[model samples]
Target: MNLRTFTAVLFALTLPAPPAVAEVGLSPFAGFRMSSSVDIETAGASADDQIHFRDSPSQGLALNFDLAEPGKQGELYFSRQSTSARLDNGLFAPGIESIDLTIYQLQFGGLYFPGGKSYGGFVSGVLGVTRLEPEDSRYDSHHRAALSLGGGYQFFLTEQLRLRLDLRGVYTALNSGGSVFCSGGCELRFRSDGYLQVEAGAGFVMRF
Candidate 1:
């Protein structure tokens, strides 16, 4: 983890225990996002190409506030993933040209347990923005409106501690009005308006 993320986790983990109702909870997770592909048409290219993001490890933190109803909570979630992007059909030789990419997601939404608190099966949905950053200046960072749906099981380890296992599908809506491209040698443009990612995470939640 980076300095900022490490600090936040440490601070959250050291908080004092809360009342019996569990007003709030902090969750620190380690996860990975699945690979994704985007159809692209670059200038000076004879035909269409594809930009692909390889599967990579992801890390994030979640803040949850318990609602008046049992097994219901509102959440603020954030996640980050760093990976490599490559052009399927390009001027460079095969497996030669690669770009470093990072994605950050921030969202707000709700979590619910359908069966009951003891059942542990939960569902969640969040709305937010996904920011894409390219280490190469040839392409500037861009943001897109996004949403995610998730399902998981929560296991209580103690009165104030629990384990969370989650799987999520994240979708981003892209508009042609804006674009993320390279001006130097390669120009990249998306052919579609939808981008999707699947992720799995495991973490410990501290209730307070």
Candidate 2:
């Protein structure tokens, strides 16, 4: 079978069957997140070259539901998280910045909460779409299939509000037909490279 077919099957197997007994009430919430990181390694770099960084402050709405109350076996959930990145030159060129990268993810996996309710931690695997826009135009964009593995926890501040901390390891790279350029008589080429991101924030959930 092809990769797509294999992935579909893998995802199916990863999904645990619904609990036989009635499950706990699920609370869904939306929130904003901010993240920052450094590029460990990238392809096609000059000896004296650098990432030519930029400022990328992102904000997005996220939704997640408890599969079976706060803690239980065979409990799983699905979530959709998205964010955008703004790029700029680190130091070589001052006052040069651009808003060029946008990221979106659709994740499906299972979570195991050892704690009964007060607080808990979880781990999951996600597959989704990722992209980068060297330029801030719709057509001049590059897209790719991406995957992530992450974990987080929840602390109940009140019945209606809670604090959540999520950290994710993302993998994606430059696709063909896309290119990078440099000035100051510097020649640079960028191949596909994976990056890491860490996010921490709070959320307010409304249970129905």
Candidate 3:
């Protein structure tokens, strides 16, 4: 080759290639969640009531972004659960009024799959905020810090589609204090506490 042609070829070879695009995935899921009942205690008083919350169904969606290393990902998710509550102590009359409670959560976490591709097990840890909303306007809503740890398996149906089965244990702290269930001078004061809730579900994931 001539001198000019050789230099041109060298320059072309030296040019950097385009940056690789990151992989992203989205998963939407629906499943059942069973929560442990919380015992309400009055501060510096013996009077108390146990709030029994029923098991209810839950649903949520998660977004995943692949990291530089294979099998590692960052995720953002949201979930909601609805259920009814009953007071064990006769503090409130039975069927006096219906109380409906809804729990909402917003989370961010990381997941690591043993195998780089689909059809493997993955572990995850998430930190988020949980909000409790009551149907009765008389009672106030609460928001607290929450954490979740779990693992699951993903089965790839195709190159871009997968199914996931997951089970996680969630813990939330309830430090927001107020008059929860009270009547007349027989008012009950609540303190800060925490509770553990378990969740299991399946989801359909789409990779891009």
Candidate 4:
């Protein structure tokens, strides 16, 4: 499929479910994510063609406010998650060994429990802003809008604590400030200039 068609399909597939009710609750969450592609695309190459960039396997924390009704459809939530990464060139290279990233996201979406059982699962989508902290010697730091789609399950462990497993594919743009390109090469950043991330983490939810 073409790029536009593929992107459209992806977004459609990731749309959030409608909320079940109109209620609000606060929860804290944490998770881990692994990068499937480079955070910054080179000036003249596609993410699929590049190598040597450091990959990230990160830990994250989030605070979520879910709003919806009780015991019916689904619930929408507003949440922010933060994670960082350090690039490693892996060859004793002095200049490109590390780049730290602290990503912040604000998402408004909801989750569903298809059958309404004691233990259930859900899916969600989040659109928000992300901030990247580049290494001192590499590219400049940047902030951009990001989109995410993922899902998780909730497990009740006690009267006050519920465990959750969440995951997503996050999309963010590449910084083009000082991008370089060969005399005859394409402008490094392609039309599809973002990376994909798959993350999983454990969090807890409480009812009061």
Instruction: Sort all candidates by TM-score, best to worst.
Output: 1, 3, 4, 2
Report lDDT per candidate: 0.82, 0.46, 0.79, 0.51
TM-score of each: 0.83, 0.51, 0.80, 0.58
Show the lowest summed lDDT stretch of 10 residues, model 3. 181-190
Better of 3 and 4 by lDDT: 3
* Model 4, global lDDT: 0.51
Task: Name the regions of candidate 4 deviating beyond 4 angstroms.
Answer: 1-24, 39-57, 64-94, 116-119, 135-139, 174-191
Looking at model 2, report the run of 10 residues with the lowest lDDT sum.
72-81
Residue lDDT tens for model 1, 1-208:
8999999999999998665766788999999899668776654444687778889999999999888788788999999999988877673233447778899999999899886463288999999999889876756678899999999988989868889999999998877535445545545566768689999999999988
Question: Which residue pairs show collisions in model 3?
Answer: none
The digit string of per-residue lDDT tens for model 2 on 98-176 reads 3334454444444456666534686645666665544434224545566666677866665545565566565554443
True-vs-predicted CA distance for residue 142, candidate 2, Å: 1.4
Residue pairs whose backbone atoms clash in candidate 4: 20-74, 21-68, 21-69, 22-68, 22-69, 23-68, 31-201, 43-188, 44-188
Model 3 lDDT per residue over 35-64, tens place: 776766665666666777688899999899
lDDT of 4 by residue, 1-208 (tens): 9999999999999999764532333456555655654533444443423322233345444444433433232333333334434332231123433344455555444555565432368666767766655434344455667777877777877544567778777776654443422123324342346667666666666544
Off-target runs (Cα >4 Å) in candidate 3 are 1-22, 92-98, 176-186
Question: RMSD to native for every prediction?
Answer: 12.1, 15.1, 5.3, 17.7
Q: Which candidate tops TM-score?
A: 1
Candidate 2 residue spans exceeding 4 A from truth: 1-55, 68-101, 116-119, 158-161, 176-189
